[model samples]
Target: MEFRLSEDQRLLVETARKVGERFGSAYWRDLDARKAYPAEAWQAICDAGLCAIALPEEHGGSGLGMLEMALAVEALCAGGAGSTLAQLFMLNPIFGGVSIARFGTPAQKRALLPGLARGEVTFCMALTEPDAGTNSLEVRSFARAEGDGWRLNGRKVWITAVPQATKMLVVARTRRVEEVQRRTHGITLFLVEPDRPGVTHSAIEKLGTNTLPSSSVFLDEVRVEPEDVVGRVDEGWPALLEVLNTERIVTTAGLVGTVELAIRLAVDYARGRRVFGATPIAAYQGLQFPLAQAHALGEAARLLNRKAAALCDLGEPYGSPANQAKLLAAQAAAQATERAMQTMGGMGYAKEFDVERLWRDARLFRFAPVSEEMVLNYIAVHDLGMPRGY
Candidate 1:
């Protein structure tokens, strides 16, 4: 199998790198310090049309697939933007935009996709409730038919970028879980405006990745029109699964990028640091092996990520590979950042080096979108014919 990136993919990597460089470490560090958003970097991304790479040409995007989008996001991470860039660009444009582009009606597409492509609008997924977490079937949010539309009431927690999002795709139970033969059924997707009469949100303080705010969104009798439903009613499980896989792949790509950055920082410090007066720390294999091992793991994670994204683009079953990639990539990012900290000694812990920020952000991947445990459960049950665990 060919491993080389095509010319277009290479260009995408280069362009993304340039965008990341244009923002630089100082830009990201300042945002992290104040728990502020990456507004400038996002505006730059929008001006460059990076938000629409995965969108169809008819929808005013570059007509690229997920693999290409993953490549760009990886570059963004590698160039020092880290997880913030993904929250600003990928979370909405790739994950939320793809759902609408693929399933929305003609009118829906005409009204939404163009604005999303132009970066004038952004969408956030409101799937995770305080109680649901990974157990989507446990979502207590419910919606009922009202006149020509639906009325929704629910609470969503840990929603990324909700404050900046113009719209949200909320998953709610249209029928009681006990009434449905399968728990995954009875769930429906709704595209709702966050500024409506009954919709309100409060910013949630998270441990890391503060460049994009997390929020708790309250939907109290919010109304959604009939056309806002994505895919078939009570058939949102499959559609949500697709969106999850896409999110995992892109999130893995971001982790891989962060790993690359960590390795670079560690190696650079090792080469320049002099402890014995006459020799550099790079002379010691003790410092070298861990960084080398982290590099190897990052390389492997990148390959798995590419494979998963390729499967997604080909319309093939990619659930197993996508989960594997995300699990491994998250592990690699955590290991690489930890190793970088070890290699740099105390400097890695300092905010100036920026390894601390990456370390914190990398830890989130181990538990979010889908946890490592949940990924393992899925692999065992779906791929290995094992009995369900949870």
Candidate 2:
């Protein structure tokens, strides 16, 4: 890859950043305090016509690809909304819409894409079960073929944005693990309406980003028609991989972008804050060097994320790169937030400064979508050709 953005890409980034700043950090801070949904921010993002950046132009999108999507997300996070707005992007654009655009049958596209492109539709993924955190293949959710449809029954935990979303991308096992030749064989993906007869959600109290709620979703014999399947039944693992990898890119972009926000918060605070003999805290090398190192790590992760997204756009093997990018992005964001809080001293713990909120939000990145240990395991086995850890 050229490792540079085109003129049009720059414009997209600027526009997204402006939209994000229109809400600003104060807006997000208040939302977290109130534990309110970001209805106004969501509508504003939809009004900007930014949701369809990764879909084909024929489907009311910009005819762009994953790299552009990541760019827009990064700019939005940097603009000031942070991961709060980035999660909004994750629900509609990256997870639900992009996969449907790529793999959904024509009828499914016609039914879903227009609303998705306009941001009229919302989605929450029902991928994680209580017992199947990192080992998704262990999901006990079963979809049994009956007559012309399937009956889905199981529970999903830690699902995000469940209440507001019109749809849920449910992952279930179409066949028992022992019945399949490989552990991955039975996994299937379906697009089910959250309001369907047998589905329910109970919000899970979480750490931060209260603006976007997480929940436990219950499914009891939910009826799904053949048209609801995103890809072939029991052949959906590949599509699932695509969805997950894109999520990594989207999330990595947001984390990378928010590094700037956190760093700037600390830097500005340090420059003006003074205690000992009128000397500012910014003069201290102890503070300066860590922030500088955090900046460098953020930049490196951004480059890696871009490369992974570019590979995704080109239909190349990007699993290793995407996981690597996400791993670095998580580390970089965590470091930035921790350092920013350290720089703010007592103010960092105070909600009024907003670095504390950023700190709380960034702390979850290393665990979700994938974990740091899992990424390291993958790299050790796949990239470095080491034996898989027992």
Candidate 3:
């Protein structure tokens, strides 16, 4: 029932905030304009060991829990780099390292975890295909059995960090659709090396979060050894559920951070800008009320995010809460960003103002990880005990 962060957690958040502040909004805006990666900022976070906070100490990490990771992400967003940078760091722990730490074979962990902890290697998940947007169960990618190994063939679109990733936690079907008892069954997870001969990637021109790479990945008969299988073959649907829930929670944490940043920017601008005769625009109720409302919504979303992360760390049943957190946080972030843009008036449309970039970045939250519609569906069935819509 403890609501406050521990002293150590507070320190972790403060350190992340300092690192994020060093980069500044101008740096982020410039990177977005040039469509460049935040290599320096990422390296700084690595040097601070923030990248490895959730990894086990044996793997050269601090072995922190998901709550600490969420706090760090929120702090990074609040410090001004926006959600794009927060998104970059949040994935390393939840989607990248957690899978290896939990399901990877001993040899796999020995080979990958240490390097991942040191940020020497980065990973991205390949789940969504051109055909499998929200209906991930309809994945067309197949992994055919080959002499004590497998050969995977598929094209995955909207894969993040593929160009920079050394490994991809790919989900592919091993058994044909008719062979499985259920549609969700017969799928398998594989940690495939992206640098292999059969794999090729092309970057996509994206609207926001342009600093981080997002590309379409083509896998042409990529060879995978037996050791590459994560968890068990044809039982990957369950493993993927775990990964999805974790992704939802962590991604929402980053969005909560972005909302905080947007609120701050709006407040600062309102206090500085003069509208009528003498006082600042913030003196008027019109400007102040909306900013207050944004702050309240952002705070509520932050609480929900922390609650979801805590449940995840405790190994509690978190699927519903995770979805709820993501849905609420993303909605709050999008609203806040839009309001911030409006609060800034003409300057908000300009890239130099930074809210314009945040506005673009906020739009992605409503669509990625899981969409708002999907979250509502989950709640209707799982939380409300309603009949399945689909």
Candidate 4:
């Protein structure tokens, strides 16, 4: 795999970095404290056309690929805007736009995607239920066929960007579990207008990522029209899986960037702060080694993420590579953030230094989108050809 970015990709990264740099740590800290969406930052990204890089040209985007998307997100996080900026910018395109571009009818694409490209609309994933967090195959949200439409009834939890989203790509069961020959079958995808009647949501108070809201969505017999279906009925599992690699790859890139930023902050603090006869702590091997090790791990994770994203852009099979990248990047971010905390000591714990905020955001990746244990399980079963354990 090539280590260097293409000229265009480099330009894209530079543009994203500039956008991110416009928002200072004080801006993010205030928003995180208020648990409010970074509306101004999000609008800046949209206005710069970064949000639509992956969309097709006809829909007013650059018609780029996953590699370009990942590059932009990485730059955004590395510029100190962190993962909320990345998620708010990319979630609609990677999760919803890709699915629509690939599977939607021409009418569906025309009706929804242009608004997405213009950032007039935001899309959130409404997949996880109270009982179906990691194991989405067991999702109990049911959509029953109605007269030329459908009626959805269920609850979804841990849905990101709910407050800011205008639409949702909702996954539901069309057939009962016992009726399907396999667990993956009988699932369906629907494009839902979230503000319509019978649809209600509340923001979840979480440990981190306060700049964006996670929500619990209640779909109480919400009506969906026939044109809103993303793919063929009872075939949503494969459709959802089609975009999982995109989601994982972009997220891995952001995590890598965040970890790199943590390492940079730690190293800078260690070098400048003097202790014990005016000696820089960075001179001590004890403080230096862990940060160095974290840097190595973060670089390795970045390489893996690059490879996975490149494969995605090439239209090659990238599930294993993307999953592995997510696993490594999450671990690397956790370690790097923790090391940054230890190096900065009390200052790191304080909000002004920004390491504490970065630390909280970094830890979210270890579980959300996909857990580390699940990635290992996938590697064990698919890569190693072992019997499924769970």
Candidate 5:
């Protein structure tokens, strides 16, 4: 199998790296401290067309595959803008626009794709609720049939970008819980506009990744038309999986980049900072061994991420690969960031150094996209011939 990036992919990676360099740790730190969105950095990424990396050429995108998208996100995170712009841009094509492209009507595509390509409109995936974190089949949100339309009533928590999103892909139950044979059935997905009278959002206070605002959204009898249905009514579980799987793979790429950056920073600091002797801390075998281990694990995770992305680009079966990639990469990132922080000693705890921020941001990966435990369960049941745990 091929192990290297193509010439065009390499060029895209370089472009993302250059664009990301404009917004360094300082900028991200300021935004994080102020709990404000990184509008400038986001606009820069959009102006570079990074947000359109996965859209088709017909949709005003570069027509790149998920591999190219992963490379671009990796480059962005490697340049230290990991916390602010990676998720927004990297997932734009797959999570934001792909549903529309794959399942949207011609009119929907014509109406939404161009603005999304230009970053004029933002989309949020609304699936997770307070009661249903990992068990998405237990969703309590309901979309009842109205006069040739639907009225949705539900509450979604920890929804990213909901406050600023013009539109959202909301997963709700169109049929009652007892009406379906499988809990996964009878669910539906809709693209809901939050400006309607029945929708309201409150921003959540998060410990990290503060650049993007998340909210608890309440939908109270929000009216939607038949045109708003994505894919099919009571068949949205599969459509939502498409987006969530893409999210896992792409987010893993960003985490891989963050781990690489943390390793580099730690190595740089360890090689320069003198301790008990005339030489630097790099002379310490205790520190050197862990640093090497971190580098090796990060590299391994990176390779897995690329493999998953390649499978996605080829339209192959990617569910298992994507979960594996996310699990490995997130673990690697968390370990690498933690080691880097420990290697930096007291300075790592300080926000001025930025390793601490990387540590905090790296942590969200284990819990997001899919939790580490969920990945393990998926592997056990699907790959190991074991019975399903959940």
Candidate 6:
């Protein structure tokens, strides 16, 4: 299958590149230090219409495909804007807008999509519970009938964007696990305002990605009308998996970009830092070879990412490629960041060079959204025809 981008798609990447570089490195640095949101950068992304990507045009979107959306994300990261800066798009564009476009009812779409497309509505998905990290089906959050609506009660940990989010997409169990034939059953999705009477959130202190905070969310009898539901009740597993695949593909693309940025930063530093008075450290094969390997790794992951994204847009099964792309891209970013730090030596440890920050950010992709071990398990069972290990 051909992977050449159309002129418009190419232009979209270019536009995103400009937007990503406009803030410069200092913008991200300050935000990381202060642990504050990149409010101005988010506004710039909104003003540039990047937030409208990958949604139906009738809902104030750009009518682009997932491939284009992934490309936009990659460009943003490659322009020296790291993953955290690009996460603004993830909340509204991928998780909120695209998912709603796929599964939301007409009324629900009309109520939320336009605001999401405009970046006015930010959504934080509450899926990971303290007890259910990799095993999302084990989530114990439940919603029960209450008058004409449902009352939800549960706790979610490590949910991102809770402070900035106006709406929380909650996943709750409608039946006990024993009542369901499959773990995928009895689950439902609901949208609730985070500032509701019974909802509270506390930020988690993390090592990196300080610009966007992840939180432990508490839900106690949060009430929601039927209109708040997305897709069918007790059938949210497919929808949830689809959103995870979308996230893996697009974020994999961003991870590849981080790999590229880290290599570039290291290379620039290596060329200038003289090791033996006259010879620059770039002459050392140790530093140069690892970056080269990382570049090749990122390139391969980028190809797989594009293929998976195209498959998604074509309505084909892409879980295998998506998982594979995420695995490699996450590794590539982590390796590149580590090498970048080593090449820069003491400067790398210091936040001024940005390698340390990149290292911290890159490390997260290895586990979050999905872990490396889980991806291997998936490939072994689903792709390699091996017996289930987990």
Q: Please give the distance, in angstroms, between residue 34's alpha carbon in candidate 3 and its true position after superposition.
A: 1.0
lDDT by residue for model 2 (1-390), tens:
386678999998888889889988888888899998888877777677678887777777888888988888888888776765778877888778877887889987887788888878888899999999988889999999999889999999989888899889999999999899899898889999889999998988888878899999999989999988988889888888888888889989999988999999999999999888789999999999999998999999898889898998888988888898888888888899999999999889898988888878877888888999999999999999999865
Residues 1-390 of candidate 4: C-alpha lDDT, one tens digit per residue: 467777888899899888877876678889999988887887788888888888889978889888888888888888886665667744688767888988888998888888887778788889888999989899999988889888999999988888778878899999979898999999989888779888999988889999888889999989999888888999888888977768897788888888878888888899999978789998989888888888788788888878887887788888998899889888888988898999999999999998899889988889978899999999999999999979
Error of 5 at 325 (Å): 1.0
Stretch of 10 with least lDDT, candidate 2? 79-88
User: What TM-score would you give candidate 2 relative to the actual structure?
Assistant: 0.98
C-alpha RMSD values across all candidates: 1.3, 1.1, 1.2, 1.2, 1.3, 1.1
lDDT tens digits, residues 18-79, model 5?
Answer: 98778877888898788877767777887898888887788778887778888888888889
Mark the regions of model 6 whose C-alpha exceeds 4 Å error after superposition. Answer: none
* Clashing pairs in model 3, backbone N/Cα/C closer than 3 A: none
lDDT on C-alpha atoms for all candidate structures: 0.85, 0.87, 0.84, 0.85, 0.83, 0.86
Give the per-residue Cα lDDT of candidate 2 at 221. Answer: 89
Clashes of 5: 0
TM-score of each candidate structure, all chains considered together: 0.97, 0.98, 0.97, 0.97, 0.97, 0.98
lDDT of residue 381 for candidate 1: 95
Backbone clash tally for model 6?
A: 0
**Model 1 Cα displacement at 352 (Å)?**
0.9
Looking at candidate 6, the ten consecutive residues that score lowest on lDDT are 81-90
lDDT of 1 by residue, 92-167 (tens): 7755687888877778788888888777888888999988899988999999889977889999999888878888
User: Which regions of candidate 2 deviate over 4 angstroms?
Assistant: none
Which residue runs of candidate 3 sit more than 4 Å off their true CA positions?
A: none
**What TM-score would you give candidate 1 relative to the actual structure?**
0.97
TM-score, cand. 6 vs. native: 0.98
How does residue 99 of candidate 6 score in lDDT? 65
Against the hidden true structure, what lDDT does model 2 obtain?
Answer: 0.87
Name the lDDT value of residue 171 in candidate 5.
87
